[model samples]
Target: MESSLVLEKYAEKNRFYREITEKILSGKTLNFEEALRLYQEGDFYFLGTLANVVKENLHQKRYYYTINRHINYTNVCTTNCKFCGYHKKPGEKGGYTYQVEEIIETLKSTPELKEVHIVGGVNPELPYEYYVELIRKVRENFPSLRIRAFTCVEIDWLSKISKKPVEEVLTELKQAGLNSLPGGGAEVFSERLHKELYPKKIGYQRWLEIAKTAHRLGIPTNATLLFGHLETDEEIINHLLTLREAQEETKGFYCFIPLAFIPEGNELSYLPGPSALKILKTIAISRIILSNFPHIKAYWVFLGVKLAQIALLWGADHFHGTVIEEKISQSMRKDTVVHLSKEEIERLIQEIGGEPVEI
Candidate 1:
């Protein structure tokens, strides 16, 4: 089979991507080449149309969102990742750690917020107990508020510092008021990409281990993948497969968030960000690939209001809600909005022909 002929035969047989589109529509997974071609060929307009069929089939016009606040406990990290612009230097003026009392005070200040997402750079001065104490105090302050804090990297850090297994650290954290783990720091699971792009970050296995442990401990978790950096098509699929396999094992992932790499003052300033079309394709692929997980979330923070509104047609069942304070974006994101108001989210969904969910 000649190379061009093989590719041509696929296009001819599919004939307007009917076969591939149906494969996705029928709830089947698309491989590396198929997923990449969706991005490479400039055909997302049609792809988004097809993906909406799945979205409507699975989720009609209903959209899911939450009232959440993202708090950065500390910005000091041991791993000075290359693509990070938010981490302060060791002697940097703004580098400071929040005590449990300070964090409780911050939580007390916000009355409407029910969920708190606490994650930041890996801190050296604060040991695992600091996190435990923080979670306990936050819970003590607001017993009803759900704490969606910590990342896989932080889990691995706790494992090392406390000299305990990952499961033990997670158990301790959970007992102290940790509700669940947020899906961050999952840039790309490709080892080659990981070594090249973020050498200071945790390894792929460590991340999987932490999520798996959290699931075993009966903690619900959210997973994410960062595209548009230095990952190949096969690498992207591999990242998805890693996530899918973990979900299959634990059945704990609540949402699959496909976050775009917003290149601003980011360390990877030279890298081009994913286009609107690519972002849509990624959302569609996430919906098609992550069959184990029930929800596919479209994070409006990095994608901005316009693209996120359009993404509803691309199998995005959940429109991520207003993040009261999002430093993660300003750290490396280009499209940084403090908080997309409820009114803004509602209008966007209405524009997309989807209804905003009250929850």
Candidate 2:
């Protein structure tokens, strides 16, 4: 459909969206039914306008990016989820795990880094002490760097290995200086897909419980959805709504990152990935639907830099930092660079007329 005709045609047929738009413009919140209706009936331009209204009201022209780095401590994992192309078995030809000293050395080499985003495979061989010591050592060395490490999946695995409850494990990690939760290991929330992809991993409800526990203990976290692969629109809406309800309850989710499933080295590589339009639509709809969620991030690493810049206007307020080294995506598709410089990220934000915000 033509962009100009989308709003006009919908305005004539459906009074619902028009009414919702008025509410949105008037700074009123849309209820669940209204949001679901918008997802079903709202046109591209209409959704974009409503989303932009929210984005501008919250942040104006200023977009957020981070001066950070990503460190994948180990690629060895036991779960072996079908959608993953990065995990390797222990003692496998390509598997590697970084020691605490090695991680500290790497952190020392990189200066002016605001955050260190760390995630790795759920390797059972790595002792629980390794993770705790890693966080303690990093925090001890760099008191200022925000350590956003581990996913709910890792936490679940940690609890199992350490024979501790989820809350107890989280408490120990927080005591050892774990700052926040990185959004990973949450591929989708649909039960059917969840089992097919990651049967051995923790269930969706378990993931949410772990997150809620972290929130209760004062650890803020980012939420994510891996879309564009065997999931339906209803499943997507359900996933978003689930996160929305959780956010409303705990107020711990800081951002919602929509991950476009990259089909390359995974078992689902036979399927095609999402299109650019779908990606933008997901980003824009996220802003409109997740009303309580404060920020939506357009991760340049997964979506690519150019598409990420375009997503800023599509209602994404956060650009994931200068990921100095990203391995998970590269493992799937080995054609891209492993790191992006801070200046390059700033220039990309500037080109889109967004103020580069670093924190």
Best by TM-score: 2
Per-residue lDDT of candidate 1, residues 74-139 (tens digit): 888868777677888667777877788977877777757768989987887887778888888888
lDDT tens string, model 2, 118-212?
Answer: 99988977999999999999999999889999999999999999999989998988898899998787778889988888898888898999999
TM-score of 2: 0.94
The candidate maximizing lDDT is 2
Task: Specify the poorest-scoring 10-residue window by lDDT in model 2.
Answer: 1-10
**What is the model-wide C-alpha lDDT for candidate 2?**
0.86
Clashing pairs in 2: none
TM per candidate comes to 0.90, 0.94
In angstroms, give how far residue 161 of model 1 lies from its true place. Answer: 1.0
